[model samples]
Target chain A: MAEKHNIKNPAVKRILQEVKEMQSNPSDDYMSLPLEENIFEWQFAIRGPRDTEFEGGIYHGRIQLPSEYPFKPPSFMLLTPSGRFETQTKICLSISNHHPEHWQPSWSVRTALVALIAFMPTNPNGALGSLNYKKEDRCALATKSQEAPPKFGTPERQRLIDEIHEYMLSKSSPLPQLAPSQASEEQSKTEEAKAQVNLENPEALPVGAEIPDQAGDRIVEEQELPVNANPNPAGVEASMESSSSVSSNQLLQKSDARVQNLKPDTRVQKPDDRLFTLAAIGLAIAIVVLLLKKFIKSTEYGAVFMDES
Target chain B: MKFCKKYQEYMQGQEKKLPGVGFKKLKKILKKCRRNSSSQKPLHASLAAKTCPDHCPVCDGTFFPSLLNEMSDIVGCFNQRAQKLLELHLASGVRKYFLWIKGKLQGNHTALIQEGKDLVTYALINAIAIRKILKKYDKIHYSKQGQLFKSQIQSMHKEILQSPWLCELMAFHINLRETKVKSRKAHALFDGCSLTFKDGKPALTCELFDSIKVDIDLTCSICLDTVFDPVSLTCGHIFCYICACSAASVSIVNGLKSADPKMKCPLCREGAVYEGAVHLEELNILLSRSCQEYWEQRIQTERVERVKQIKEHWDSQCRAFVGV
Candidate 1:
């Protein structure tokens, strides 16, 4: 099979060299090999960087080498759903084909895979095919990334992807702290929901409810709810910690059935608040006009009296 | 005179065989020393009681230590000479880079060629010496200690062939072939010296004689190719920098420097060798100069890779500070 590529092409020679090297010094972090049929297309899997959301994740991707490879960088597309990158789309990276200007001939599939791992933790900064999924969601995807190799292309390609995923599973660390934190994560979500209810109808809630939240906290939670929720799971964690601290107190309170009914009440309050601000501004403008009119009328009367004198 | 010369030659042959004369006797002598030391009798006193054999003047204890001392001496001198030659070449290269000297003295290609040749000769001679001594040791002692010592020196990075400077010298010779093309006469010194591939392994083959070709292995054990931007780890293994960096830490953005101190070499498995990795700039220059198109492409690619690295580094730093 190897002798089939006995041609004198430099790219083929380089790929063969890399294949031999990759076999000799196999890395635990990644495994890559060109297809048996087409030496230009490679399937690879990378172990996510440790201590990161992607840790314990085995991400599978495809590499399409140009005929002038090493000179021209290879194009990369993730086959697995890593929250960091959209699946089956060409990802833009300094080490990938999207940035040919940055591709080094000395860099092989090995270095690129390593770079991919390093890039896992970095901000996408809105690069093409990048996704800013929440850390929790990313962690979830990371776990899911290990479950099975992505289904793509031919049976051979699928087999290759499966083989790489298997290699990565054996190499990557066990699924991270995500497993243990899952129960607590769910508990926190329910607590947040209960807190939202309390926020909606603070007047209806008993004084002994022990929500312990200030008006400022309520305003922040309301403002940060929908827009920043996915991007900033850390904010959710911070709120979780505070909620957990007062959890024992809230556990003794009545069931949250009555709190659910008051969900619409908070929605009603937002527009009322806006209207109140508008009315206050209107009153201030009316008072200023009245004062100016009185002063002008008095001044005109004084001028007439002076002329008569 | 003819008879005397024949007799002298006959004596020399007998003398060569004399070292192996008392292997059993030496073992017995060592056992006596050990027994004496164990029983509280002085070791020398016990040995002094027995007449020393003609073939083995010194006991095994003193002979092995002295043999080791001789071995170290050979290695130490070779190391010093290699370092001095490398320093000379590097200093000249540096001065040339800075344009310190005026014309007539500015280009020292001849001097470099001579130094490179000398370094290669020194390495070859010293390596031969080590091999001859080890063979002699095994012959005398009827043991594999010489072979063991050879491997021990290799692991210790004390083997003369393992020196990074020798690779630089080869590069200089290979590069000189290109630069000295106009001076056909000077090219004679570097004739038939070039990098070649044999069975997928890269080697520097220099043909000094029609029958005497010296092959210096240049294949990066990691990449299985003629090293591109070769870096010598403290373990004395030469690998392409990119290969070593990937080996050390696939996820580290800072290349080899950010590698864990305890990370081991892929070839020798020697730990903590990556930190002091020396990038052989002279060898890199030689490779690039000798191969124009390949070098140009590599240079462009490297420049872009560097730019991307710098960009990534700054982006990460900015992210840290700006909390974005």
Candidate 2:
């Protein structure tokens, strides 16, 4: 019946087209129903944005388009336990009832869904379609919702989401240069440094990486050595000189490459080289220190020979 | 000057031939004659009426025919002397007397002119003077009526304010902020009423008729005459279970069942009356203390009458058997 209706109605045709496009290139944070049956009624699951109380939440709601659709508008009802609005209540919105005149016929289902997701976490007073909830309560709900099973009434709805998720994951290709193991190693080094400083306790490690594990213990030992083993003055001086020289050489190489790329008309290249010049001076200082160390060692050996005589 | 001298000589010769022709009367005749002579010369006279004829002095186009006819009737009512005086007054400077009178007529001062004499004559002369002023003042009158309508609306607002319960309820549940008491009385004044304040705001907003469904029970729950505080439970069961315990004066040591948890719910026999049952709060709130007492008294009287009727029936049957 819906297929027949879609064929007959121009508006249904446009809505179906938009739905197909949205499904083909689905956003990571949004999920929508498929276009097969009952195009007037749709369900969506939206992942909340970061840094908000609703972050990590997968909210579920139903959209009901009026029979005159596109020309009229659609209404929405939230089924999940979102703290902002009462569960299972139809919320009034500008696109719904607050301002029917502003509703444009050209606006698609995807546009409404995007707007609905973006409008979450807004202050509720006088805001059409916005629900008010305590920040703490919302944050708690958001955290709880992360573990909730992605349940839908029909297999079609579930399958649609599964397909979209698969599509998005496929599209998000891993960086070629940064291998998985190398990324983990860099992550672990930062974690070890953080543990040493005790800004956040080491016990609160990433999930699946237990605190008492052998790998965690080795990283902790490495962090401790920087503060402990480098206490000897001569060894510390040699290590510092070598580290400075290596860092300076890296900086000089970066600047040389930048200077080659810079056009003659661009007068700002000198400022870009300031860090490289500082690195060069640091390298020169390290070289001087090494020479001085050598000279001191020779003098000490000479003094030892005279004593022996 | 020569033409004027010739016209004066010609007029003197005519006067001598026709005796007793005074200069003032002759001049009046001459003026009439000149006006008549010009009108008789038909140089596009048919076009005269077509070219802006019957133009309203006030509006500068064809006048509203009905208003002009009415104005002419008013003019006709004036005596010749008053009409002359009005024309003279209009010809001089002022032109707003009629408009002022019209304004005063429509205003609170309307009654004052009705009580005065010869309004039509006075209106006509004054009407011409105040024509422009009247048009301006008519707009003012319209605005004043608009203000009056606004004040009437404000008075309606005050009426709604008097019953904040009805006002708030209508606003919350029905979304109707303003309602007339007369209309409400006409629509919803019935024997039973329901009270519901479900939204947590202190306003009762439920349909009284729809919510009042309860099965009949023989025993009062409170006075146990039949459940006096008949509350419907969540399980869709209603009983005067509380009334029964309170009426029996069962001690706290003796539980609700001691009075009767075995008491069947009037609506559903499967359900039994138990402790900690939820009382339909809306119904309880609506049933006033006095109304409850009246109902209890009425029920007891009806029970006594029923027993008397049964005794009379049995006695008559016994008498008939003895006679046989």
Candidate 3:
């Protein structure tokens, strides 16, 4: 829950801001969240952007935030079995504090996530911890990423996979929930966490239900905390999904100001749709008028119909 | 020093000329135009008209054509500015290096730092101006053409950063940061694969830049990081030499510029790339000048990589050919 965070420290504050942003308005291609126990250390699962060798892969990774916060850039490591990067090694990138001179203070965790996704398909050249995986091998690993959770992290991280699943399930509507197949994917999402990944796009994310929170820091996910030790799927009162969306929708109305910021295009799109509908109606009315005038002039409708037929 | 002063003034002078299009003003105009058309209740009837109401009220025939010309002018100006900035940096670099060589270097770093600051300011300002111009163009066109325009301007930033002048400026800053650590090895190879001149004198690289503020435009599109050992292809798209070669499927041993007729520019994906890629000499110079240590460390790292690549793929082929 958002209220549980300690927002006193700037590092915590930034981490909370970033986490809350990612949860509500997630990148359609990736999912990342900080652990309830440690805000500084985050667990992330990224869908390799489509049209690349990494396509269809759901990569799990960790982001360790320095206490210095945005002033210091974060380090990123991929944990999934993607052939491009050796699993669990700190990736050498100018954007990743590897070249501090290149780090811009304006960059945030969201920016870094974006950079990471974009940077994956590039030829490794000679970057530290990069691999020149064959295209076939990468595609094979990408397929395996969907079914297998990373073997590296702790069990709690395995639980976080389920959390990532629920987050994806609740946020991206077109995507089918991978949590059901989480058993084969390596763990099961029960009362605590549940998920698997869709290999393809469902067209779009859930349109209006996303709720953006300004981490003054009380944000609530659900009555359920992200991590639950009690793994009884049946005992839960409301279904895991039904409750998550309900809380998200409730928060939607409460944060109307911030919600608009999340979906800026929605406001512009409304007028365009209305204009289109108005134009279509006018065309329909003009055609009807033309038909009536012609029919009346021709006298008998039956005669006109017989001639037309 | 006079030229540096003039370049500084040029940025300040250009500021008002390129005063960017305002977001609020544009939005307000668009809203007013919509309201006027929609006030007649049956909105669709007007919309159904052959002329259609979405046409921009701001641009007439002359205006749209003029905007394109304006876009070119801005791009040309930035390119020219970049060239001038490069000249100033190179001139001063030569002056500093030769003075050091002659042992007459009076150690007045203020002028050097000034030039570096001026270069950053002009590049940044031109980038902003180009973005504004592109955004205005897109808003008027109501299409993704603005993004295309933005990329064109962006390539300039990419080019300017490649200039030998920036490389010198960068080296100056790198030295300032690590005053305590003597550069451990040969000239710092920015991308590590670059061939460094052995026993070459360390040129005038100090006091130009102390702040490591990197422009986003300076980033290599492939690496998503600052461009290093930058080389521009025939298409004018710039990239780190290693990145460019890798993307082109050419090995570092073969080099990007070597005869590879079938090779095409990776970003454009269709344009026939020249057998000879333009070595971003100015940019490489900037890299060697700015941070010799980083450049050197990278060279070491890439040497290991080159060996690995050869061992993994090329070594066996050579052995087979030689019957070893």
- The lDDT for every candidate, in the order shown, is 0.59, 0.40, 0.51
Please provide, for model 2 over A246-282, each residue's C-alpha lDDT reduced to its tens digit, 9 standing for 90 to 100.
Answer: 3212322221222222222211325656787567667
lDDT of 2 by residue, B1-324 (tens): 332342234334431231111324333433453354346546456334332222223222212223334334333433232333333223321234344445467662222222111222122222322233223323422223223432343333221111212211221212111221222222231222122221111122333222322122223221212233444432333434333233223332353445455443333332344443433322332332223443444456445534564576677778999985
Q: Which stretches of candidate 3 lie over 4 Å from their true place?
A: A1-309, B1-60, B84-116, B133-145, B148-228, B232-239, B249-255, B259-262, B265-297, B301-324
Q: Which 10-residue window in model 1 chain B sums to the lowest lDDT?
A: B14-23
Off by over 4 Å in 1: A1-309, B1-64, B67-81, B91-94, B97-112, B177-193, B199-201, B207-214, B221-225, B250-258, B321-324
Comparing 1 and 3 on TM-score, the stronger one? 1
- Against the true structure, whose DockQ is highest? 1
lDDT of 3 by residue, B1-324 (tens): 332333334444542354222334444544554565567436556545523234545433333344445445654554555455445444543363455444346643444443344444444433444445456545533456557545554444333433344443444333333223332122121211121211121122222122223331344554433456777665555666766666666667777666467655545543456464665555565444444454654466457657776676688788889999
**lDDT score, residue B46, model 3?**
57
TM-score of model number 2: 0.27
Model 2 scores what on Cα lDDT?
0.40
Q: Please give me the DockQ of candidate 2 compared with the native complex.
A: 0.00
Quality of candidate 1's docking, in CAPRI categories? incorrect
Residue pair clashes in candidate 1: none
Tell how far residue A119 is off in model 2, in angstroms.
1.0
Which is the better candidate, 1 or 2, if ranked by TM-score?
1
lDDT of 3 by residue, A26-81 (tens): 45567676665566787787777667998767788888888766556788888877
